[model samples]
Target: MGQSSSTMSSPVIIPAAARHTATLIFLHGLGDTGHGWASAMAAIRPPYVKVICPTAESMSVTLNAGFVMPSWFDLISLDPNGPEDRAGIEKATNFVHGLIEEELKNGIEASRIAVGGFSQGGGLAIHAALQYPKSLAGIIGLSCWLPLHKDFPKEAKGNLTTRLFQAHGSADPVVPFHWGAETSALLKQFMENSEFKTYPGLSHSSGEQEMEDVKKFLQEVLPDN
Candidate 1:
């Protein structure tokens, strides 16, 4: 339960219970703060991993009628295609990338660090992880799709060895399940270690089954000594 301000808008961090051998930097969805998902530390129960949940800067969202809220980037539309917010996404990508570098400076290798998120944050996780220059332990996305997926081919080589665990509720409406599948399909072409799971009757959020899967994924990718 310690806090540090790496940026004007910093994240809520839960230090590892045992030795801090790994870092899990997770992003929050639109309109949510880092504290919103801070409980993930307990849910995952990875004693060797430190959890970092960064808060997104407040900004007006086009999908929400331009009302300002905490968002990783602006959503020009929910069309799953253009009118994309390229500039905003790039800024957030760099912001998250900065967090990765901080962990690296603290002695955590890129292969021992994981990045994940829900919804908008999940999409950014996929976008940023693909563009990151080093291989990561894993990438998790819950009920989110890849933003700018068509451009992934040119960028796939950045983290080809990074594993992915993406799950979507079949009934997800905000970010349709089909879109998530499409992203998983494309990722499998270059990211051979990726896996996508489906929750038959869930919605836009997660539940016990999904959390269990995440725990297993972390244990597999960020194993203890």
Candidate 2:
């Protein structure tokens, strides 16, 4: 599928109370804006970590029958193994990479940064972060699967020490648990540390237990001073 022009607004930012030493760029899923996840960021982020949530541009999604919504890329097909949207994925990756660069320019080292997302956003997180040029602190994927899986072996670079935390609901209908587990397995080949967790009767959304796991992952990877 063809991609649209690159456009972005000022991200919804939750700044740290003290001097910032780390950054987390979290992306929201399809049909959702950055604001939707702002409160979650506020709750889970560490005291010295600033969170950056960028709003995906509104676009017509093919799977949604051309309905306009905020999406990182066009969901061309619901089939997990169908041909992926390479163009749209590349565009979103560049956009997210820009955000990481901006943080780096502001003095946060790549080692102190993490990128994460949920559902569609989570797919992009694992896809892009593995291919990102610099090593990051962590990669968080919640209730989401990996996209462009085959391309990783050829295009993946950096972030060897970066830990990956992927959690999926075994009962999730949107992104199946098997897919998440498979992605986590593939990630283990590239990352030195990777963890995968499954919530027994949970659905496509996150809950307190998942958040607690995420909090622990963040603390272990990007601890506050």
Candidate 3:
């Protein structure tokens, strides 16, 4: 598989308001590209802090019968205890970490950059934030799971200061409610104010009301204008 780059082509959404104090790094789900979730960015709001949606290196997913797809990892199932490609997950984590590093090198401070995603993207966000060296503006995951079932890194308890806003659709047939419950509980076991919202009757995709919730969460997590 091709290794990830410090910079990748992304579909970006720039807020017309003044220069943003922070940049939001948006990662897409399995089988989806950077541009796939550009739809969600629309409801995100005005004076847009810069939003960067990056595409993953294309690869085969055994779960998808070896079909090459843009993904953070090959997810075998939404079950928290299901099979996973640990190596693939680690590589993806490194790639995401590299993206964050590149952004910092380009002038966005660690505290001013927020990393987030949907489904598999959400899983990766949790993975990198826990492993990150410093606190970030925030982390968001919509209909996602934890990357692995392993114990949280000991350093994670102390290093993680990033505020988490996790939202899951109660009707999400892919990822079950239990997964979101456990993930949220796990976060609370580690950090202060790791927030979780279960959208009643919502399905795999976010609806307008839920999307508005995301906007509110982002605005709350981001620094004041």
Instruction: State every prediction's TM-score relative to the real structure.
Output: 0.94, 0.94, 0.88
Clashes, model 2: 0
- Candidate 3 regions exceeding 4 Å error are 1-17, 45-48, 77-79, 153-159
lDDT per residue for candidate 1 within 63-87, as digits (tens), equals 8999989888788876766788887
lDDT of 1 at 136: 92
Model 1: weakest 10-residue lDDT segment is 1-10
Query: Scored by CA lDDT, what does every candidate get?
Result: 0.87, 0.87, 0.76
State model 1's lDDT: 0.87
Using lDDT as the measure, name the better of candidate 2 and candidate 3.
Answer: 2
Clashes found in each candidate (C-alpha, N, C closer than 3 A): 0, 0, 0
> Which sections of candidate 1 miss by over 4 Å?
1-8
In candidate 3 the C-alpha lDDT for residue 178 amounts to: 73
TM-score of model 1 relative to the true fold? 0.94
lDDT of 3 by residue, 123-192 (tens): 8888878877767888888888788746574546333656888899899887787788888888788777
